[model samples]
Target: MSHDKKCVVIKIGSHHTIAGFNNTELPQCILPSSYIKKGNDYIFGTINMLEECIDKYENESQQTLEIFTTVDENGIPYNWTVIEQQLKYIYETELKCNSKDFPLIITVPHLKNELANKVVERYFNLAFNKLNVPVFQIVIEPLAIALAMGKTSALVIDLGSSGCNVTPIVDGTIVKTSVMRSRFSGDFLDYIISERLNDLLKSDTFQMTDTDGDIILSNNDSTTRSLQTKDSIDIWYESNTWIQDFKINMLQVSDKELPELERYYKEQAEIQIRQQEQLQQYSTNNTEAKLDAAAIASITNNNPLSQKKNFLFKGNKNSKQTVSLELRECYQLSESLFNPALISDKYTKEDGLGEIIGKAIKKAGASVSSVGTNTVGSLGASMTIQPATNQSKNNNPFGSSIGGNASNNSTGGLNGGINSLGSSTTTPEHIYSTLLTNIIVTGATSLINGMEQRIIKELSIRFPQYKITTFANQITMDRKIQGWTSSVSMCNLPSWELAKWYTKTDYEKESNKDETKEN
Candidate 1:
């Protein structure tokens, strides 16, 4: 618990894992939480190599190599062995430090009690027994994210790979009743992108042609060369690296709603098409014709609907080809986050990102007096700090000890407890005011361009009564690793304040106590 001793901060995300020493500003290792298995050997953090292996063995031999993820779709560790292996690599190869030497702090997603308890117990066992870590603790991602932003209370909107989680942290404690989760997230957007791309490839309107403007293959062809085929699409999806690269490089949230943006672009395209026809029919002087041609070119160049970008698809063997997509198509992928109904009929307009945020705020506002009371019925995990004898009373069975003392003062720690609101009486109005003004958005999906601005625009329309102030880290890295960065900062606090960190001795004592109770 001492600040002098180095602490290891690890954030286990659904898609990626970030790890580093607490003293560092950024994570030392940011790698996929996945591994490739070939025979008895397991290769971790070699996604690019996996892609190459897939290409080499596409049709040459039986595919023996298999890729595995440490966590499930819900961000819970499903494969403990793989998770342990990932940690071992982080400690030995990346950090180049002995696990026994430092205290470990891990960040986990906020989930239901049964699931949260399972995740926590698995990690605690992994840290103490497997890694031989002397001290260990788990901090829910929302709390760490709040501390990282230097706010004890904020509406934290985490747009992660697995899903979008809108958690309300009141006085540094998670408002369990107010937490809202949705399936609209990074991976969902990826699926939407793949589906859209498939449709575009099959359509005659959008054709993939070579430099000479000739089609590469017949539309009916189902071979590897034709990306239009289902088999080829499956191959492309399997090479997740290329799709991930495309998402990161090209995806962006539109400034306006998808329907409005589409309408505007459609109008612009029509006007340009009419102008082109007029220029072709009318005969004018050479200078006038040249001027009109220049005007049309300027219009086409400025119009996003008319503008297209070519990306090389390298997922298939001997199938490297340029796929041209309208800029509007790229924007549509992220726009689905704002309007989930745009992609599928299963989701209604209420399932959008803005609506989720509004719902979380309303739920938090409704339960103002019960904010720090620690029980949220069966809908969510309880926030209550359990007695030493009862570990199952709360989602955080390790209790407030893991949270530290999240003071609103200069000294940063995990906030929550009987006195979370401090000496001053916090009314419903005061809590609502704090949450509305300090909205914090963090996660990989939030890194998309215009995401922060779009959220703000949406929130302003929903909550006209209050002044909305949303905070998103301008630094791209900071936003991606906000949870880990905050965990490191929490480790820097004084030893007494971080008493929440469970030690090996404490675990032993608790184990002995449990044994006695069973007898």
Candidate 2:
């Protein structure tokens, strides 16, 4: 096959793998990163066949089938065979191109040096030996995100299926020592939402009523179709697709803290109680006359707590059921990101996203300053560290009341500028300021409603000095496929710039050099 000279960008994420030619803005195909294994045979691109395959496996006792994900929580592919098969499927079936004819660009998460070298070697072997690609390159997820946002330096906060990664990129180089990872992410939200849904279903306060106002009973009840059972709950939670849909469509991060939200709901409940007492008193006083239906309807309409919405949950066997829940419950699902204690006992407030970002920034600043270098290599004099300006201290773009009372009093600030690691005179404040100002939040979980606003609010509380500005792709699809699109963008750069890409010839030379070394 003749080379097309077009670059193929493949962004392999934990949940999905996006692939396309570099000429397009968006990816041509986004497929699940999971494969179904039946006995010895592995099946790729099992999106449509997933449910059917699971159903078949359940129905047939003698047959055995297992579903496996190509990548792990860190987005590293552990199953090379499955990954190779998936790549072949993307190249031949989806993109309709030969792997040997075009250059390949893929994204990988930031790993330790030892692990990174091993991973790079594996990918190189797979690209040159297995797939026979002309050229191959690996781009770190955070670096790709920076490129997508058109920034040379950024504090990349990626919230994906596995977890959150706060990586700092200075002058297009990743500050490896400063990267921070947190478990409170999309998959964590899914688990939390599933548990909350399970609890809601089991709670006596929760009532599932149909459109006709008939109470729906659990599956164990002989009178009506049952939706509740230990097995069914487990199965429902295990369904990643359904849980992901619920999280994306229904879940939202609350801008306020848990205490504030709780207080508001408590106050509303108290008001409702008082209204009920008044209604009872009126009824007792007017024993001779019955209250009119219009009066009761008027009171009900006025009460915000009386209004309830139904969430339709589609289950197996084509069964569709509605579960009634307050909007507050849905918002509470994402609160765990800001307050991990809401979900897990092991995590403290320090484990929250804002705190992690703060720590990451501090670490990055400390790492750079420890080297006794005023500027990171190739960053230029324009990017040199400078003293805090008066404008940065007086002007706050995030507003005075956005993140509640600023923590500047407890944590010392440099000339009224918030330092991520409290007051530190030795650490260069400019490095922290630069990273804080250019924060880029991307990933699937970042697509949650009010996520960006909540992050800004949280960061503002901690770091009140710099006007916190975070760039997030407004379009959900664009944000989700950002890694793929960014790789495509990088591939469009000048040929000289792409000299870093490992070509077939380069691989051959390295192999020959290794052989010579052995001899």
Best by lDDT: 1
List TM-scores for all candidates, in order: 0.80, 0.76
RMSD of each: 6.9, 10.8
For 304-372, candidate 2 gives per-residue lDDT tens digits of 433455667654433346676666666767888877987778889788897898888888788756644
Q: Compare the candidates by TM-score and give the number of the best one.
A: 1
lDDT score at residue 141, model 2, on the 0-100 scale: 69
Show model 2 residue runs off by greater than 4 Å. Answer: 1-4, 51-62, 203-217, 221-240, 264-309, 373-427, 511-519
Screening candidate 1 with a backbone cut-off below 3 angstroms (N, C-alpha, C), the clashing residue pairs are 401-500, 402-500, 406-413, 406-414, 406-415
The superposed Cα distance between candidate 2 and the true structure at residue 474, in angstroms, equals 0.6
Full-model lDDT for every candidate: 0.69, 0.66
TM-score, model 1 to reference: 0.80
- Residue-level lDDT for 334 in candidate 1: 86
- lDDT by residue (tens digit), candidate 1, 161-192: 88899988765566666788887898787777
Model 2 global lDDT (CA atoms, 0 to 1): 0.66
Off by over 4 Å in 1: 47-59, 204-221, 225-240, 262-306, 370-397, 400-429, 514-519
